[model samples]
Target: MAAAGSVYEPLPRPCAFSPRSRDLLAISGVDGRIQVWDTRVAALRREYVPSAHLSATCTCLAWAPARGIQEAHQKKRRKSEAVDNDDPYDILTIGTATGDILLYSTVKGELQSKLVSHHRKVNCVRWHQDNGCLYSCSQDKHIVEWNTQTYKVKCKWKGDSVGVSSLCLSPDGKMLLSAGRTIKLWDLQTKEVTRQFTGHSTLVTSLMFMPIRAAADSRSPPETTGLYFLSGSIHDRLISVWQVRTEMKQKSAVLTFTLTASPVSIDLAPSDSKEEPMKLAVVCRDGQMHVFEHVLNGSHKKPLAPTCTVQIATSGGDGDSTPKPVSILSAGFCPDKQSMVLYYGSSMQPLFEKLVLKTDEPHMCLIRDVKKTLTLRKEMTVTKVKTPVVKAADTKVLMPGIPGHSATVTAMTVNSETQEGKRKPGDQEDTIEDRLGAMDIALPKPPTKTILPRADHFSVLLLQGLESCDSNILNKVFLINNETEIKRTVAKLPVHCVVPLVNEITKRLQGHPNGAMFMVRWVKAALVHHAPYLSALPDLGAQLGSLYQFLEMRVKAMQKLSRLNGKLYLLITQIGAFQMAQRTSMQSSKQAKLVYEEESSEDEEPNKEHNASDDNWEEEDEEAEEKEEESEKEEESEGSNEDSEEEMDVDKVNSDVDPGNESEEE
Candidate 1:
């Protein structure tokens, strides 16, 4: 069994490649120092050390996505001379053993911000590509999701009682895989465990997802819903590859293969062909890497064997005949997937090497053309270094606040009315006794005018909200107060609060646009109602001048926007007119076609009428010819009958003649 103290021992230096540029690698060193190197040229780019005392070493490192780089650049107000010229806005996140996460910038070569939410060491950190959300797991059994824009904890949940030692996010960014004694997959949206694997006997140290594009089928769309992941445990000397399917709804994770090695880190290189599985590289503690070619070929019934095992040898010895074997700390593939960068050796003098994959030979796949990129040296120290503190001018340090208003409290007591000097009652002699008795009589009290308090409820609430310097509370206060109430509140505000109010408005004007409109109105009312009081204080005038400048800039922007809107409107109008012209032309063409069709029909109708008239005349002429032929035949018959007496003889003769002629023709 391993010693219990081994669990709390300092982890190796964490290193990671930039998500955007594989040539840029970030490695953490002792004393909370981070170093960036250009792997392509084997050159050191920048090195950053935290100003505060760091007792713990970095446990993990991750580079923020390119989108985060853009965000950092956009948020920057001014350029720093120390910023790197080539890559001016790169951010690297470092997780330390103290359970604190530090955001370091390559541009400024300094720490950007420190986040603390864990009591134990942070084990792993992962970034989601789409939303730029950061997920971190720690030995405190806590998983925290952070919003990169605000650097605030967006969500926190207890992942497992044993504590998570590693984390990997799915390609779709909907599922998360965390490894400890048992590997568990979580649904990020519901924060529920979707699947669990208890194959490993020891804590899993490294977890990585297989590249989705490498396994995608060309016949279908890329399968981002499912992926294979590799998890390694140092104590067990085992690397297990598991496959998740169907949006992480698989009843169980299919273990594709298990490779044996005390893996310090695991990385996968996407393959070019679907027939070939991704190349799995596992860097072991003894400076040995096991490269498996067909480990994730989708056959989970049996474990696949590694294709090649490469040994990493040490560079030189301290004037000795033989050098000690190198101890690899971490290893990761390059962007091209053809080579890898390795960080190894002791922390006192760490070394970096670029290992290229050589597939030309069958037996020896990894070629060690190790290039010495950069070396990190550490010096032992205990004293804490304090940065010099410089106090700013009084004007800069002064913050406006409401001063207490003072008023005198006077009470007048009247016991009796003045008596006439005529001594009405001449009772001067009766005197002292009468006066004392008259003074002793009680007199009715005069009516007192009520004085309202200097501040109203809304004014008090607004003042407290502003003084708290909380935007949400101040926004709520503004939301609840009406325009009349706001005006009254500003008017009642003291001379001291007036400047601060203006300053707050000016600062807010630089923020969200929705609040700026109301803030402008509030500032306007403050200046108008308290002009005399503000003018008396020169500092107040400076604040007002800033407000004016901001408003002027906003006005110019609004005017530009208005001009753009007008141009857009003109374009839309021209398009509408063009469309209208097209419709008119089409309608005219259709009407002309209809008219031409009607004229053609009219011409055909006249031709038809002329042909009908010609047919009628031909019919009349044929009828007349038939009648004339019939009359002629009847007259001939009558003439023959009149000569019947002679015709009998003639008919006989004709018949005889016809017979004779027929015989002769025959």
Candidate 2:
């Protein structure tokens, strides 16, 4: 028997294989091109430039399952119209740097749409088998849902404060699992966060959901299958399984299993086959692949230990000669259930393959096919088994800000204009009366006088004490204050300081320049109220205060710049509106000047023309009489010209028609 926890020597680095069934094997090269090798005679079949223009590395790749559909329709004439056709071979979805997702069809060997919705580098992409939707997560801290048919965004789920590193969909397509530092479960139907599982101390690298069973137990009243979620954490080098019980009122979920190795990727065996038990495949950072079979007891209600474990060799050599194991970036079983493949490495040529138990493993190896032996007995027992009376516990925890302050709470009131309840100004007479009536009779009126805390309260007491102190002493005080007030403030420090504050204090105590400046700014902000001593300690107080103020101003400026950049981006994208606004401003200015000029000239024109109107009217009447006689003569000449043109047109048409008649007579 193999040692209980012995590490296996993996195959050599940069190894490639073609599965026994597949004719073409895809290998991603360091040059950012996918090389397709014909394994039948073990040679290169074709080299496809999926992303030849991209300089960034390819992070992940997945092939969609080929689905066959058969539809039966009734025609308008009462005849049955049946059509059956196999869906096109699943497209290959590749995720790369620059946050672009490319889909390629294997049948056509042509590139499909390039999904460019993600703002940052895309980390992973997964296709939902049942819905044919693509889910992709990126370093932009966003997970996008895509419609595979239309290639349009269906929806987007934003991550909380961190870039998403991995994503997975449940078997039923009802739940979406995503991971970064925390694991979040989303209900696809509601598009709301269902639950957040916080167990990993570091980043969660990968996640997979166990498959649900198909048929209900005959003896039981059709019990629904339970859901199980698995996650890999980098900090603890552990694999955790979480059981999700939707039936429970509280949504009872808990970690069920934890492994020792850091899992980089995980995949569960397809649950379609009744003869094969469910299995989990996990690839670890140590360049090892582990597979475990799911075992069920007689009741088929509780989970048992894995029946068997297989650790495949991925890289090889003695400890001293062997290079450090690169992470297994991704792993998946083929649709035919013949073999599995895994991609590992940080660079472009990261993918590697391993041929585990083949499709014939069950039929050829009798001892290994445990499910086949128990198939008959299991069916008989399952059919006759009686349903057990099980009570589900209430798992609902009160949501924050429901009715009263149950936990930590804070409140802020907005002005009446901003309040959710709309009320006109000066229309609160009834509201005031109702509030007064609701007040307790025994309660005394609160003090009307406002109290301003003393200036000393706002003064930087720590800075005053540290004045003229050495840098070492100031550093010590800063450390102490950081420890003390860290919990009081809600604002999170930047990433560079977070690890030092939370994980390592001693390592950062080396008095770095950045840390010194941070301490000085903090101390200065603390000492602003010491006006009396400010004159005496001008250098310390003034400089520190100025520095503090400068930092604050810089941060505000950055925020403003970000807002301005967003506006500029919007302007560029919305060209029509921007152009219209510019045109409207120009037109308004010109119109304003024209209006002013018209107003000034109006008086001059009216006065000058007013006196000449009587003389002009006499001349106009005489001209009108003479013009009418000339106009009648001109009208008669124009009418004769129009009549002549019409006659010519009619004669031309007759001549043209007569030629056709003559030809027929001849």
TM-score of each: 0.50, 0.43
- The TM-score that candidate 1 achieves is 0.50
Task: Report the C-alpha lDDT of model 1 over 1-666, residue by residue, as the tens digit.
Answer: 111112112345577866634667777664445667665654556765443423355678888877453444554445544334456337788886667888776665556777888877788898888888889998789899998777789999998886688898877788899986578889999999978877765567778777556434455555543367777775556666677765545444465444444676677786655565677777666556667777344546556656766655534544654434555666677777777776655443455667787744433422322333222222323222222222222112111223421111122333354344454554445578788796697766865986676544767766776666666766766664377877887876667566667767777787898877777678778889988766443223223544665666778889899999999999999999999999999888776453333335577896687677885887777888999999999999988787876868887789777887777788
Give residue 218's lDDT in candidate 1 (0 to 100): 53
In model 2, which runs have C-alpha deviations exceeding 4 angstroms?
Answer: 1-27, 37-45, 50-53, 67-90, 214-223, 249-260, 270-277, 296-666
lDDT of 2 by residue, 1-666 (tens): 011222122111221222223445565654345655433333444455422323334567766655411113422421211121122433567776557788764434556577779856676788787877889998788989988767779998686677787888887778889887578888888878877787665556667776556464434321254566777765355566676665552332343333435565566665543345666766555545566565321123232333333333223343544333344544566655546654544323333444555422322111122224234334532111111122222122121221111111112333566566776777745677677777645666788997764433212332332233234643454554553353332122322222122212222322474674445434333333333333332122112322433456557889999999999998887998889899999988777553333345667886667566876877877888999999999999999999999999999999887897777888
Flag regions of model 1 displaced more than 4 Å.
1-11, 53-55, 69-85, 214-221, 224-226, 246-260, 300-302, 314-324, 360-666
Q: lDDT score, residue 646, model 2? A: 99
RMSD of each candidate relative to the true structure: 28.7, 36.3
lDDT for every model?
Answer: 0.65, 0.52
How far does residue 260 in candidate 2 sit from its true spot (Å)?
Answer: 4.8
